[model samples]
Structures are given as C-alpha cells and as structure tokens.
Target chain A: MLFLKRYLPLVICGFTGVVFGIQYYVPHKASEDLLTFINDWMIIIFGFSMILALASLFHVHYQKIRRRQSGWGFSLIVFIAIIVTVIIGIISQGETVDEKGLTSFGWIYTNMLVPLSGTMFSILAFFIASAAFRAFRARTLDAFLLLFAAIIIMFGRVPAGEYLWSKIWGAEFPLQMGDITEWIMGVLNMAARRGILLGVALGAIATSLKIIFGIERAYLGEKE
Target chain B: MRSIFHLLIFLLIEGQAFSQELTPPKELKAFDAPYDSGNVLYLTWKGMPYDSEKVDYIVYISESEEGPFFEIGRFKSNTHFKADKNWPAWAWKRTTEYHYFEISSFIKEGKEIPLENGKTYFLKLLVTDGIKQVKSNVVSAFPKGNLFNLLKLNNLIYMIIFSVIILWFIARAKKRELFLRKIPALEAIEEAIGRSTEMGRPIYFLTGRLGMSSVSTIASTIILGEVAKKVATYGTEIKVPHTDPIVMSVCQEITKQAYISAGRPDAYREDSNFFITEDQFSYTAAVDGLMVREKPAACFYMGYYYAESLLLSEVGASIGAIQIAGTDAEHQLPFFVTTCDYTLIGEELYAASAYLSKNPVLMGTLRGQDVGKGFLMGAVFIGTGLATLGTITGAMQIVSFVLDWFKGF
Candidate 1:
C-alpha cells in the first residue's frame, strides 16, 4: 500500500515528465496527436481538481462558522457568495458558460466581479506612493542611484516632464525628459531584464530536470 | 457589283488587324518547394508583358506529360510573377510526385470570349481584337518531401550536446565538492525565524498567487519546507495563508512533516496552513488585514508575484516585520527590493531552495546548471570574437555558418 501510494506517483511523474519533455523536439504527426490527447486529459483532470479545492474551501468555512471563530461572519459571507454565484451560474448558462449567451451569470460577473476587482486593484495607487516614499531615501550610493532613476522615470513618463524640460531649456536642450526616459527604459531596463530572463530560463530548465529525475521531491511532501 | 466591292474592302481591313502577334513568355521553370510537406509544387516564369493590357496569362496543370490539361488559374499580365501560389488544394498529394504546367494567353477579339473553352486540354491561345495569340513552353516539376530537414538538424544536435553536458556535470558534482555563491535572502531566513521566535510573534509565509504548477511556486515550496522545520525547532507559531487550494493542502502536509521531523509533532496545527481565496486582490486584501491585525514578526514572500507584490511587501514593511522575499518575477523585483529587507533576484530564488536544504541530488543539479551556463557564456564570448573578426576581414563564411547553425535551433 505504501509503495502504491508514494512510489507509484513518483514513477508516473518521471514517465510523464520525460515523455512530454521529449515531445517538444519531435515533429512527427503521431507525437503531435499524442501530445494533444494528453493535454485534453490534463484539462479534464484539472476540472476535477478544482472541484476538490472547492470542497476544501467549503469545509474550511464551515468549520470556521461552526467553531465561532474570530472571523465567522466573513466565513458566512463567503458561503453566501459561493452558493448564490454557483446557483445563478448553472441556471443562466443554458448549455455552456460562454459569454456569447445573454445570461444573468454574465451580468453578475460584469457588474459584481469586475467592479469589485477594479476597486481592489485601484487601491494599489496609494500603496505604491507609500512604498515609493520609503524607497526613495538616499542613504547609500545604491539608494541614491535608485532614487535618481526613479525620479527620472517618474518625470519622463508624463507630458508634464517634457513640457517642463522644454520651458527650462528653451526647446534646444538636445534631450527631452521623455526621450531620456524612453532610452533608459528601452536600453538599460530591457538589457538587464533580458539577462535576468536568461538566467531564470536556465534555472527553470535545471529545476525541471531535477523534478523529472525525482531529485526534487520536497514538493511531493517530504524528503525520504 | 458595288455591294460585293465594299465587302471585299472590309475583309482586307479585318485581315490586317489579325496580323498583330504577342511575344511568348521566356525562361519558364517549375520545382518543388523546399522544407515542406510534399504537397506544394513551385513554378516561376519570366517575360510577363509589363504593359499587361495587351495580353493576359492563364496557368494549366496536367497529371501526365502528355495530353489533357485543365486551367488552374488565370490573371492579368504582370498581376503575378510566380505560378506556385496557384497550386490547387485538391492536387495536394502525400507522396512525392510530378505535375506538368503550361502558360498560355487569350487575346481579346471584338466579341466576348467565354475564357473557358469546353475542352479539358489544349495548348492554344485565342486572338481577340482581330489579333493573333501565342503560347509559352510547358514546364514539369517533381515535388517530394525530404526525409529530414537540414535546417532543423542543428537544433537536434544542440539538444543532444546540452543533455550530455548536464548529465556529466551532475555525475561529477554528486561525488565532489561544488562551490556555490552565497545568497543573502536565503541566508536571512534563519535569522528572520529566530527574530520571530524571540519576539514571541507568529511568522507569516505568503505563497504567491500562482498555483503549484508554476516553477516559482515549486521552488518556494521547497524553501518553505526548510523554513517550517526551523520554525518548528524554534517553537515559534507559523501562519501560512494560501491563494491556491492545492498549495494550501501541500503546505499543510509539509508543515506537519517539518514538525514531525523536528520531534515536535504535538506543536503542529493543521489550521495554521489554510486557503484564503483564489481571487488575486481579495487574497492580497486578506493578507494585508492579517499583517495589520496579527503583526507577525517575520514575513516571507516567496513565489511568483505580480501587482500584489508591492501591496504585501509594503504592508509587511509598515508592520516592522523582518521581510525576506524571492521570485523569478523580474518586474516585481524592484518592489520587493525596495520594501523587503532581502530580495532574491531572478535565478537566486531557484538556487535558494537547494542552497538552504543542501540535499545532495538537488545541489548536484544546481552545480550541473552552473556548468551549462558557463559553457553558454564561453560560447557567446568566442562566437562574438569570431564574428567581429569575420566582419573586419570580409571572410564571413565561418561566421555565417556558425550563425546559421545557432539560428536553426
């Protein structure tokens, strides 16, 4: 039982990982067909997994309410939101959940979900300001450089920066703030970003190799 | 007698008009398209009438060299130079085969010509406007797919070479000592946990919004196992609020295992690792609220993060928590760097897990990756030098060959 429970999964992981990794290099029709078939199965399996997660969520909230935890009211609200949303979703969706159908589910998503998400996202503006204020302190060489770059970027991204530059330099200053900003972002930032991305790619490949060989099993719960 | 003389004069005028002739197209050729399925036959012709108004071209295809040809397409002169574009979809074959093509013209007469003569095959041009028409020579091509594309052969070679190198390094690294540079963010994890323990406050871990399938999340989970073990040993309470359900369940097991391994199984609480919400901002809001209310001494943000990175890190900073963070998300690095005490940049996040755990296999793989990267760096430097020399000397065959080889991949 223990072997079937643990070793079996690892074996399956190794087999699938190797097969899919090799599939990228193959251009044969049979290889492509098999890849497509497995991808479909994955989607179906993911659907089932989501259901399991949903069950776990409900159970967590149910326990919270039952035990009268500190935020039990919020737990009750979560239950209400989920149940109502699911019921409306199934009822309004005739045969499919595609937005092409004019349904109350779409209405709920557009009106309730979108606005709520947007409101929450808009709050980031204030958080950015707060973070910027703290980050812009010039205590060290690195800090001073960061502060300078941040100031230049902030000024260059808007029309006001260009307008101020033109007014101060009589329009012949040779470099506009916007142009400087564009150069900094396009040349300096892009170059650094690409270098980091290359390293990240190599790291990802190594990690994938480790997983395929079953060397990285910490994610599988524990090291044996 | 007078009517007969007028008819004779009209006949002579019509004969004179019919004497005009069209020049036949020159240097017509046909061949199979390279690097594709055996379906396409390419045909090219020169000497299309640049004026185009005097003559129009029609293309015909035939199965055999002899006999019946059918009109595949027709166009105004100069409309198209290549006849390959008109390969009929119905004529597409799985096997490499041959087809014959003919280029002909239809000269317009005073009367409207139907353009399609009922006959299936004939190499004849019609004269219109009382003019004479001409036909071009027929062209034949045998199209077939090659067994292998030389264009993509380099890609296969590179893949094999890289695989061998990585495997060789891994084998070597397993038995020998490999030097690894220090990552400050990973080193601070222990100090952060100890601080939390001394402060008598809970340590909070925020796994990013991504699920377990992402590489960053996988890396983060490995690091989490180490952190949880340390927390268990220190007897500090730890809270993990997850945005993904599977991550939450996996984390719960990891925390439990850590506690068990620490010989403090009684101290482990299942409720400590629980799902908050999957919605991005909602999860961020919940974490922010937790940071304000619970005020954890140490907060670790380790995984793939996006817009919510700044929000979470700033809140942690505001709460005076000892914040340690790591991710492969480059854009979010600036935020984490500014707000968190220590930030792992790019690949450092990946290296952190293996570095902290010191698992022989994981460390071996990391060393192998370094070897691969070193090889790539050497290749880049040498290739750049060779290319510069090649350009200066105007002897670019070697550089071109090298570039083409790399481009294939």
Candidate 2:
C-alpha cells in the first residue's frame, strides 16, 4: 500500500503530463475540451485550498484563545475582525465595498491596510539609498564602474545639468552630459539584461522538459 | 573699351527683342535631393506649349552667373536630371554649395541658338519634327542644402557600439576571466542552517511566489539543497513552506537528498516540506502564522517576491531570526534591501547558485555573462564617440548608413 501510494501519484502525473504535452501540438476540439476541464479542476482545487487555509487559520487561533497563550488577546481581536467582516459581507449581499457599507470594511481597508502596505513598500527607498551608498563605494574596479554608471544615470535623468551649463567653450552642448548615461543604459545595461534572460530561459526550458518527460515527480505529498 | 560699348548696346537690343517675343515659364523652383545620393538637385518648371515634342534640350551648369557655363549633362527629353547621378560617384564628393543649371531647346536645321548665362532662364521647350523645331518659354530655379543627413550618422555609431560590447563580452567569457563577484545572501545558507541547529530551532526556507521553473526559484532550491544538507548533518529540523506546489515537491526531494547525502536518511521528514496557499496575501498570512507559532531560528526568502516581502521580513524580524533574501525583480529588490539582513539584487540573484556551488560549468556561465557585460561597455564608448563627431561635422550620410544597418534587427 505504501509503495502504491508513493508510485500512483507519479503514474497519474505522468499520464496527465503526457496528455497536456500532446495537447500543445494537437488542434482538435477534444484536446481543447480536455484543457478546459483541467483548467476548471484547477479552479476547484484552488477554491478548496483557500477553504483549507481559512480553516487552518481558525483552528490555530481558536486553540490559541482556548489555551490562553501570551498573545491570546490579539488572536481574539483577529477572530472578532474576521467574524465581523464575514457576517457583514453576507448580510450586505456581497456589497463589501459598496458606498452604503463604506463606514465599516471600506474604512478598515483604506485607513489601516492600504497605508500599512504602502508604508511597508516606501521603507525600501531609504534602504535602497543606504545600499547604494555602501554598494557603490569604489572598493574595486567593478565597483568603481558601477558607481560611475549609477552617478551618470542619476545626473542624466534630471533636467538640472542642462540649466547649469549650456555650452562647453563656445558651442552649445546642453544634452552632452546624458550621452554617457544613454550609452551605459542602452548598451551595457541591455547586454547584462540579455545574459540573465538567456540563462533564465535555458533553465526554464530544461525544467519544463524534465517535468514533461516525468523525470521530476515531487509535487505529490507523502504516501500513506 | 570701344568694343565693350558696342557689345552692350547690341545685348540690350537683343534682350529687349527676346523678352517681347517669349514669355518666361512661371513658378520655377529647385528642391533638395529626395532620396539616396545627396547631390541630386530637383528642378520643376511650368511646362511650355512646345515641351511635348522637344527632342533635345541643352542644360548648362556653372559656379557663377557672370560667365564660363559648363555643359554638365544633356537631358534628351526628361525634365529632371540629377547632377550626382549623371556625374561619377567620386566627382560629387565635393562640398555642398550653391550651383546653377539652365535649359534651352533648339530648332531643327536652324542656326544653333546660344543661351546667355547672365539672364534668368525661362521654361523653354523645343517642338521638333524630322525637319524642324522651335524654342518655348524659359524658367529659373535656386537650390539649397539637404537636411536629413545627420540621423544616418547617429545610427551607425549606435550600431557599432552595441555590436562591439556584445562581442567583447562573448570573447572575454571565452578567455575564462569572467569570475563574477561573490554574493553574500547565497554564501550565508550553510551558516544560517548551522545557526538554526545550534539554537535548536528549525530553519524555515520559503521559496517566494516563483514556481520551480523560475530562475530565482531554481537558485533558491539549489541553495535550499545545500542548507538542507547542513541541517541533516547536524540533526537539526527544517521546514520548507512553499507557495508553489511544484516547488514544494522539489523542496521535498531536495530535503530528502540532503538527508541522504548527510548520512542521515532516517532523519528526513517529508511532511516538513509542504505547500501553503499560492495566493500572495494568504501565503503571507500563513507564513506569518508559521513564523509566530514555530519561531524558527533562521528564515530564507529567495525567489520572485512582491509586496509580501516586507510582511514576511518584518514577521521574521520580530521573531528575532536571522534573515537572508535574494530576488531579481527590480520592484521587490528595495523591500529585500531594507528588510533582510543580506539581500541579493538583480543579476546577483541569478548568479547565486553558481557562486555558492562554484561548479566549473556554472562558473563558465557566469564568466560568459561577464564577457557579455564587457562587450556592452565597449559598444557604449564607441557609439557615443561616433555620434558626437557626426553631430559636429554635420556630415551624417555615412553615419546614417551605419545606423540603418545596426537597426536591421
């Protein structure tokens, strides 16, 4: 039974994998229907997964409250928040974000969640500036080049340089400062991007080939 | 002085007679070359009555109006004749300046009519039969410099620079000197796992939303394998909470392999690697709960990540665990940079596995990437120079041709 359970999922996966692989080449209605059925099954599975996660959340917190853990009061608050939202959601006929019900869920999402999330994201700006300061130090040849390129880009992107100097000697040369910046971005930056993309592409192709060929069979959970 | 006075008197009489007999063609204009070679001058004139049957028209070109008109070419019938096209390619390489061209038609079997250089030419056509021909009215035009020349020059410089960089990188990688710099986030895997073991708290490895196929996720998995080995060797527990089911399974094998490699096959726990929800927010919530409940000593977030980067990082931070994160997504880099103790940015995420393993093949690939980067830098230098020079000289035909070739892709 253990062996069957271990191998059965692999076999089932292999069969389905081949079917899906062949579907890519086949243009028949039956193949299309099969793909649609698979998609529908995926949606059903996703729905069940969400339900399972919610149940798990409720169980964990319910136990926490019952056992009266150190943060049990916070768990109770979360429980109350979730219960109230669900009840309001159902009673308002799924009008969770409707203007009539805006004072409740809308206020929570807008005032609490959105600002919290935005604040979390905005914290990165300071971090990036600090990282840049540390990372862009000219400790080595490569670091020097990186720092130079970054500074050029920063100067080139803004309009202040042109206003500061309109001419070099007698000739007009306002946009000359951006020349190096453009070159770095258009050439050096693009090449690095292409190299990364190529490696990623090859890795993706290899992994997909492995999956389609049934050489990889890890998605199935533990055997009975 | 006496002969000049007689000639002037005779020219005045002839000019008066010529003006009274023939009306000049109206709206005569010269346009710059439309395409291809730049030296061609376009001449348009209001057609005279006798233009249709005119078999031969005499066109004279000269540098000045005073005298010495040279016959550059003769148009047998057509109204338009390009000076550059008619002349040898090399001859038209001189400076672009103003020149003059005039046309006049002859009467068959009539005395050869000489056209004077000083007078403005009118639209004149020769009505010719086998036996006879007549002159039509004359026309005039003035020419100017062609302007679309510089765009071509800029393009050439760009192409050369781009090609040079790409080639340079490829060559350098081939020569085997492209050792990419070390990334710390990748280097800390074993240390993080060992720390977890000493602390007696399980290590938590979360491959972000990216599936197994993602480059970041693959790098993460490779690192995970190495970390798992250390955990197994130390008889330490580790849990891989995966957002992707596919990645979860990969993690399970990786964990299993680590245990086997560490000579602790019996210590491997399959349930330790399990799929949490795939939805971004839900996954974050679940992982947050796990962090709170399990209080893992170390957390690694390496893969594609988004807004949840902070939520996860902050939760892990609150637990007082050491955290290391790496990703290539530009938007998410900032989050990892701020929140994680060590974060790999952009290409470093892709370079992590090779850096950690130091396998020759992976190292070779990294070397290849450096070669590509070098080639790019060289191209940038040359392209900028050519474009700048082309602008200064205002001679852009060659540059434009080069640019057109570069833009072929």
Candidate 3:
C-alpha cells in the first residue's frame, strides 16, 4: 500500500517530469510525439477532474441546504442553476453557438451567465477606485512616489496632457508630462518588472526542479 | 474547370497581343532552414526579373516532379532576404541578397500537409510577366528531424548549473543548520490564526483561481500544508475555497495529513477544502459572499490572481479580517498590497513554503533560488554597465554580440 500510494506516484512523477524537461531541449520528432502524448493525457485527466468538481459543487450546496445555513436559499438556487445548465448543455452538445444559431443553452449562457459574470467583473472598476484611494495616499516616501507616478500616468495617457504641456510651457521647456510618463513606464516600470520577472523565473525553475526530483513532495500531500 | 477554360481563352488572346517574355529566377536553391523545426525548409531564388510591372511568383510542391503538383501559395516579387527570417545571427550565416520563402507545408483545398521528417519534397518556382510563364528547375530537399536544438543549449546549461547549485545546497543543508531571515508576514500568520481561534471565527483561505499547473498555485498549496498544520496546532478552523478540483483534492489530503500530524485527525473535516466555480468572476463573487457572511477573523489569499484579487481582499478587509496576500503575479501585487494587511511580493510567495516549513530540502531550494537571483542581478548590472560603456566607447557591436548569447530560444 505504501509503495502503491507513494513510491509509485513519485517515481512516475520524476520520470515523466524528466522526460518533459528534456523535451524542451530536443526538437526531434520523437520528442514532439512525447509532447503530444502527454498533452492528450493531461486533457483526459482534466476531463476526470471536472467530474470531481461537479460532485464537489453539488456536495457543498447540498450540505448547505441540508443544514439550512445562512445562504441556504442561495445554495438551492445553485442546485437549480447547475441542474438546468447541465441538462441544456448536454442537449445542446455543450456549444454556446452552433451553425443553426443560438440554442436554448446558448441563450441561457449569453443572457444569464455572460451578464452575471460581466457584472461581477465590472465590480472590479469600483474595487479599483476604492483600492486606489487607499493605495495612492501620500502617507510615506514610497506612497508619495506611487502617487506622483499615478498622477503622471493618469494625465499623460490622454491627449490633453501633450496639448496642455506644449501650451503652458510655451515650447521652451525640454520636459513634457507625456515624455516623463513614458520614461516612468518604459524605463523605470520596465526595470522593476524585469527584476520581479527574474526572481519569479528563477523561483519557478527551482520549484519545478525540486518537484521533478521528488525533493518537494508538498504537491503530493507530503512534506512542504 | 470553368475558370481554367476562361483563363485559357483569355491567355490565348493576351499572348497574341503582347510579346514580352519571362525568365526563370536565377540561382534557385532549396535547403533545410537552420535553428528551426524539422518540418520547415527555406527556398531562395535570386534576381526576379524586374523588366515587367506585373510579375507574380507561385510555389508548388510534390513528391516527384513527373506528375501532379499543387500550388501552395503565391506572392508578388519582393525582396526576401535570408536575414529577414528572424533566426538569430549566430545560427543564420547567409545574409546575402536573395528572395527567400519558408515552405513547411503543402496546402490543398484548405488542408495543410506538413513536411514529414525523412521525406523528400520536390518544389518548383514559377514566374509570370502577365503575358508569358516560365518554370524554374525542380529542386528537392529532405527534412531531417534535428536531434538537438543548439540554440537552447545556453538555457540548458544555465538550468543544469542552477540545479547543481540547489543540489549542493541540499547536500550541505543535511550536515549543518541553515539560517533563514524572518519574514514578518509569516510571523503574523500565527498571530492571525490565534486571533481566529480566540474569536471562534473560521479562517478563510483562497488558493486563487489558477490550477495546479501554475507555479504560484503549486507554491500556494505547499504553503497551505504549512498553514493547515498551524491551524490544527492552534485548534483554529480553516476553510479553503478552491477553484481547481485537482487542487482541492490535493488540499484535502494535505489538510487531513496536517491534522493527523497535529494529533487532531478527528477535527479535520473533509468539507474544509471545497471547490468553488472555476469561472473567474463567479469564484470571486462567491468568495466575497463567504467573507461577508462568515465574517472570518482572517483571510489568507495565496497563489495567482487576476482582477478579482482586489475584490476579494477588499471584502476581507471590510470585514476586518487580517488579510495576508501572497502571489507571484506582479500586476496584482499593488492591489493585494492595498487591500491586504501583508503582501508577499513576487518570489517571496515561492519562498513562503520553505520559510514556513523549515524543511532542509525546500530551504535549500529557496537559498539556491536566491543565489540564482543574485547572479541575475549581477548580470543585469554588468550588462547595463557594458551597454553604457559601449555607448561611450563606440564598441556597441561587441556588447550586443555578447548580450545576444544570453537571449532565449
């Protein structure tokens, strides 16, 4: 049981990882075939995982409704939505739109799901405003710099900044808000982003190597 | 069929009306394109006749020239140099003038038939001056699947070096104790968990919306294992709302194992880790609802996030939850920083598992990653210095040549 549960999985993980890692260097047809085979396996695995997701969704809501929890009504609504969507989805061949045009499933998706998801996404604009109100506060030196950069970016992103700059400065001034904004974004921002990217890339490589070598078994529900 | 019949009639009339002649392109050659997939080959021809205003070239491909051939594509006479293919200068040698076209596949009736490895393909280039047509001599080349791509050799070398550094550190760690600097945010996790226990409110953990495929998510789950163990130790409730089923399943096992480790196995509820909808905004909305309703004493947001990072954190903040956010997603960092009490910026998220676990293997990997970052920082500084020096000394070509060696595949 121990071997079957732990050692076997780890061995498979290490072997498969090494193969895929080497695949990055080899452009041979055999390597390409390996990639395709692995990708197909991942797709199959994802399909099975989706079943678990559906079951989990049902379980959570079912328990919620059974206990008459705070959002019992919402849980009931979830159950209804899942059932209805599933039926329509399977009947419609799971396509939002077919050659014949929008089916009942497509209509529900277009009308209900799209608008709901869109409305949820649209809430981020308000969230950003509130967050920005807090973030851009000039409480400290870092905050002040952020505020200054934000102000410049906000102004210079529009055409009026250039027009106002040329008008107010009367063509003698060497610097423009637009140019400063560009410098901040292109040079300063790029430098910071690249630094973060470097760290992230290195960390990613380390993490992948650790996992591939079975030194990091946290993903397998073992040591961190 | 009808179009060909009409073209035949039209060409017969045009042939009588004009006497301008066309010649085959000079110095035609077909060869395997270097530093590319085995499926593609380059066809180059010199000196397209400039005597006519309306000249068109057509490319054809076949197994053999004796029988059928199909037009793959057509293009007007234009300068297509070998240098323009965008293969790095180190790999591509012939920068001289020639009209070049990359032919990877033969198309017929909207279907592509890519060159199979080890299969010889015959190709022809035809030129027409809108009056007469001429065909170039058939050229043949066989595609060979390159056993190795030398362009990525530098990357492979760097990876091997980094792995060696990590392995060396791992071996060293087993022999001696290693010190890790205190991360205040990680320190505050215990305090936050204690608060949740005292308040009798559950702590909420979000693994973001990404799946296990993402590095950030993997890191998040590892951190979750540590967090779960800590939660078990403190007897604080931990509810993890997930976006990926595989991640949720893994988290379930991790949490259970943590509980077992802490001698509180019976207290570990399977429902502690639950799957939320995979839809981005939907999951965000659901988490927000949970935060608002449950009024969790603390919220731990870890892993990759998009726009919803702010939405969830803002709600958590509004509920007075001690929100700690960690993600490698740089763009979302500002949002997380604004709304959360503590934010793990960039690679700090990756280091969190090692920092929390204090396990030698993970700690060694983290140290090695730090060393790798140090090397990168030095490289960047040196590259910048060399570039500035080159600008001053007018030795930019040498600097650029050195820099191109570091550029990726």
Q: Which stretches of model 1 miss by more than 4 angstroms?
A: A94-103, A170-174, B1-155, B379-400, B407-409
Deviation (Å) of B82 in candidate 1: 12
Ranking by lDDT: 3, 1, 2
Per-candidate TM-score against the hidden true structure: 0.77, 0.52, 0.89
DockQ of each: 0.46, 0.05, 0.63
Writing each residue's lDDT as its tens digit, candidate 3 over B1-409 gives 9999999999997885454457778899988765555888778888543533377788888888674788877877654566565444566544545778888888766788888877888889888766678999999888877777877777887888999999999888888778899887788899899999999999998897788788899888888888898899988899999888889988998889888988899889989998888888888888899888999999999999888888899989889999899988899888998999998888888888888888877788877887888888787778888889999999875676666667786
DockQ of 2: 0.05
Q: Which is the leading candidate under TM-score?
A: 3
Model 1 has a DockQ score of 0.46
**Residues B57-155, candidate 1, lDDT per residue (tens digit)?**
666665555746655566555445332333222222211122233333223333322223122223422212225456666766655543344446666
Model 2 misplaced stretches (Cα beyond 4 Å): A2-4, A25-33, A59-73, A97-107, A165-171, A217-224, B1-188, B199-202, B211-229, B237-297, B307-409
Q: Clashing residue pairs, candidate 3? A: none
Tens digits of per-residue lDDT for model 2 on B1-409?
9999999999998886554333333444544333222334444444443333334444443334542444434554334433323332322321222222333322323444433323343232333433454543333433233323332443435433533443454445446644566567777777787788889998888877875446568667767776777788888898887676656656777788778877899999856777555656656776787799879989988788887887788778778898998776656665566567888766665555556655443445454445445654565567767677788988565654433332321
TM-score of the A-chain for all models: 0.90, 0.78, 0.93
lDDT for each residue of candidate 3 in A145-178, tens digit (9 for 90 to 100): 9999898898899988778888988667899877
Q: In angstroms, how far off is A194's CA in candidate 2?
A: 1.4
